[model samples]
Target: MSSPLKRSLSTTGRSISPPPLQRKIPRLTEHVSSTREPSVDQLRIFSWNVNGVGPLLQKQLSFSADSLSPLRTFLKRHHWPQFLCLQEVKISSKDTATQRRLQAAANQSAAGDEPSYTIEFSLPRDKYNATGFGGKVHGVATLIRDDFGSRLRATRRPDWDLEGRVLVHELDMGLVVINGYWVNGTSNPYRDPETGQVVGTRHDHKLRFHQWMLDEALRLERSGLHVILIGDMNIARARIDGHPNLRTSPVQHVKNRADFNAKFFTYENGLSAVDVFRHKHGNRQKYTYHPRGRNWGESCDRVDLIVVSRSLVDPLDAVAETDILDNALDRGHSDHVPLWVALDMSIFSAKAAQSGSD
Candidate 1:
């Protein structure tokens, strides 16, 4: 296999100044006319576990200004939703240059005109202490088209926001979009040296985090706002989600499988969400993550996902166009491919107007 793209931002040893924020928020009602009837507008939303943002932007910059890189090409192709949610960005708060580079890249337009998107990052606080690639901080980031930024109100949950795991944004259309990166619970079991009995494990923490996400989703639903939950959930919902040939220890496999099923499919009190992609394409055997050369009996799985509440499911389903960017895989950009969906935004606009009139 060809070498993956380099992961360093300052490999050339040149000090670069941070780029100024250039996003301009427009008026929320500009897109809607008072006399015109609300019509369905195709809104495309894309999600990816970028693994790291610095290296990804470095790869994009390697291309000449006249030429489009894979990253740029992917972003430019889908013109519908214009909103993006990214996970496992692995960027730290202190890395201002890298952050600016990412912001510029995401906002850049193909026509060399003013940027179309505004960017926000929920990066980890301490680069030196976080656990990941070389103790680098990893968190989630979001990008919204500049037109929608005027209607967007973003806040981090007081209890869950500090760790850079969740970002909540409410649009003036009465819709809420959440971007999240759940903890990967893969640590080895801790055992007592003398008795050889398993003492503890990180698996429990992972399960608890999953529970927290579910509870938060429910809370948002009760508040009467339409919700779109998208991110790298890090849990395979069923046996079909993973490669059949890959094998884990029997005990470990059973516990993880059970947890994933209950969290995603078990509906409590008639409140449950639907996985948009899976609902549209059932048992298709598509995997989002392909492990690179480290096979302990695991090769591929579908960990990344996009799910929406039941209230919005019918409308989303009517106009949903979902796909995994298979061609972008193995290009050394990331282990996971991008998953995207296009939905009709007219539904939300109509609902918002009706509520306002009441």
Candidate 2:
């Protein structure tokens, strides 16, 4: 059954619940790991759609500094990842006061001095975005461990970055991490502001976003960076990625999937960055999203993914582990579960460095 807090959002032309008008948006902290930790050489990355950070953190608009936020606890239990990317943050960039409170809270720790993570957020611009009474409707955030934060640089394409959906973080290791929340063509008609007439849906916007993402990834790879594009792509690239069966729109849906293949997947002579999860776990009947009020296998899809440049693959890392964490599902935190990928950073050793330099 769906949780009471479920917000309606459409995927594959199917309507899910919408977000609440107001909720607390909390910042995250970390503690010593309670679970086994990844080795020093292992670079673990995690992506999750929290739906809203406030509910997951058990925080309220009052801004009480709670030490044991569910998110902080979850990080401890899972053995804190080096980089954590989040989607559908739903916090308005227009709400600077709330954002200030969040940053202030994030700056605090048990020691009351040192920081835990260096967080960056991409939120919808007020001038032109989907804003409700509360503010912006969608956003994406990336949190890098304090120690590694210095090694990172962030960028976004202005064309689609205004919506706060795409953020590209470049590391010195010739690795570029593109964290995105792809647009979902809700198919709901909206009145055109200029024409003052009811017009088409967001289908074109969705397609353009996907195309921009593809172009950017390819562009980075050509510049000698190994790309790791991860997030809620919202495109079930294949029937295997979706449970039961993928919903279809003979014209739009089919073209969307085909364009995804022709641009990103290797099968269609596209970019070299392959879906790391599928490369490691082929044809596995697993999923990263399960809509509320729906059975597990009835309508779930592995929309979340970690696609990596082939050059980053090697025996040591060989994509050590790729998992769709069900713990989030078990907790009923979000309709979507978290996806994690473990890769050995050593893959960018002297030999790889020399090759790139050449």
Candidate 3:
């Protein structure tokens, strides 16, 4: 069999200057679509924790005068992906300035024409509700190439979705893709104000997020939809996934790791999906997140991931390629590097054909 095709951009001796913070953010209107159609047999999906869209857009505009839109520049930098998933967008629906900026950036073409991407946003609502991140801290967005996006529909649960942490979309082809920014439990133990009792609000949220995600995936599976789950899971997941190994001494941290293993990775009773990237790379020490102010490689974790249901596993050798984009680190785009997976479209298309024949 042929080797898995590598489409990652080279990160060799090239230098990209740090974007000037003072540069005036350029206004970008519509232009010709920068994205091209993928091979009929292949589909590509990309995910990144942009840190924040507002700042990322400014950096993109600073790169070149010709940059028409953030999506355009982004697609050009990496070969265009059919689906682009972003986390930690940090834009709230109430923040009109940033909201408008994001809208402008996403609409990368003439106003009268169809935009290149069909964008979906899970933004924090305007108020500080218990279920939300107070309209600022966390958000997620997904941009599907218009053709596929047009054929998709949203799936949501009020509690899991209100914080703008989860965005689920189902395609007409019986596939569901979940883009998530799982809760990162607090660094310190929490205490109730009045009673002074330990109350792990953030930690509880993290566990709930995991359970919710597992339930959603299972539900989709029972409905006969294949699932592709992607984004910053916030858990380094294993000793091998982190430099110097991640701390498991904390009871909460240990619980978190165990929970993830049981619900998602365990063979006997878990979701039984494959962490496709890891399956392909097989113990390679590459990482996706390097905490700010920390030394790269020396202090990092591979928290970003791409996972797919069991049905998709057999096609891996012939149809899939996964990569952690090191070049994104060179550009200083965000603390998290872009992670991508390419799958042959024929896998899905064949299933569709079979169903029709049945």
Candidate 4:
């Protein structure tokens, strides 16, 4: 965190101006014992699809340049959730006007308070490798609070080979986060000679992305890292209420269209048992994606997801909460809402019985 800003005289003694959004994370005074269960109270996680956050902020905050403040403000206002992660991010950091605009959003979010994230980015080395949504960079990032980032030795999946997507952060909590953005498959089509019919495109590129992500998950699993693969999967886990063939629908009707579902997200790729914010509380959330204007007209599905290692499968099953962030527009100011969970480490960690078993 940066130095606190000076206070101005207001009708009240408190300063009227909020402090600048801190780009740097704070230093931790202590570390959790690896042998003991982590202080769960100290751990909070958040994830979102900001839909190319730069433009979103620019529109809302009057920022001409892409700024970090709106992003900062969002995090702070949301009580500064401790373990922050995001998808669909922008790569540019040069626009000072926009930069100041971002800072302003951050200040508003913080309300002159402190923000916990120590922001970090893993950008494309070659500009050509980058992907964009509506002319803005489409990437991912992790905003580990100071303690989390410092304690965890960060490593990323290879940047180039990826479909402009990345995740899998090694947590000091003996866990690894499998963060990702599955490929989006969409292309226009024209009626052709073979069948004399027209068609649209599906996830041909994403199939590759999912395979790569699964391979990364398996590599971590092989290295003995406890893993939790979470983020936008770009696939539905089960058959929707109405589908032609249900599980086997995509086999023939959709030539190159991918299921992106758990059954097929990655076959030779690596993962299998994805523990979606399961419907344990009631039903897992449905409909991960939504076009702004087509709400009432389109059928919905669950694409954003959480897949834990079989090692933690049963445990994650015990404390998971997967749902579309209803406050998507308000709290998130994002298109993709957050899907969150609560795990009872007591069911899986070493201290479960030791703390009380003793």
Candidate whose TM-score is highest: 2
lDDT of 1 at 159: 66
Candidate 3 similarity to native, TM-score: 0.79
Each prediction's TM-score against the native? Answer: 0.76, 0.81, 0.79, 0.64
For TM-score, candidate 3 versus 4, the one ahead is 3
lDDT of each: 0.60, 0.67, 0.67, 0.47
Candidate 1 structure, TM-score to reference: 0.76
Q: Between candidates 2 and 4, which one is better according to lDDT?
A: 2
lDDT of 4 at 95: 31
Cα lDDT of model 1 by residue, 1-358, tens digit: 0112211212211111111122111122334222122234766778887666655463444434544433454455455246788877766666778777777676544565533666777876432224344434447888887766787866564364444777787876657778887755544453333455666654654576667777777787788777778888776677787775433443554566567566656746434777877887887877777543444224566778888777777653433567665432221355676787776777766776887899
Query: What are the runs in model 3 whose C-alpha is more than 4 Å off?
Result: 1-38, 63-65, 107-115, 126-134, 155-158, 187-199, 315-319, 328-331
Q: What order do candidates take by TM-score, descending?
A: 2, 3, 1, 4
Output the better candidate (1/4) by lDDT.
1
Q: Which pairs of residues clash in candidate 1, taking residues 3 or more apart in a chain or in different chains?
A: 43-81, 44-80, 44-81
Native-to-model Cα distance after best TM-score fit, residue 121 in candidate 4, in Å:
1.9
Candidate 4 local lDDT, 173-285, one digit each (tens) = 56777566655433323222235455333234445555666667677778876677666665555555111222233342133234344433455544655454553434533
List runs of model 2 lying over 4 Å from the truth.
Answer: 1-16, 20-36, 59-66, 100-115, 126-129, 155-157, 189-200, 267-269, 295-298, 314-318, 328-331, 352-358
Question: What is the C-alpha lDDT profile of model 3 across 8-84, one tens digit per residue?
Answer: 11211111123223323224335423234456567788888876665555424655566456556666556557788
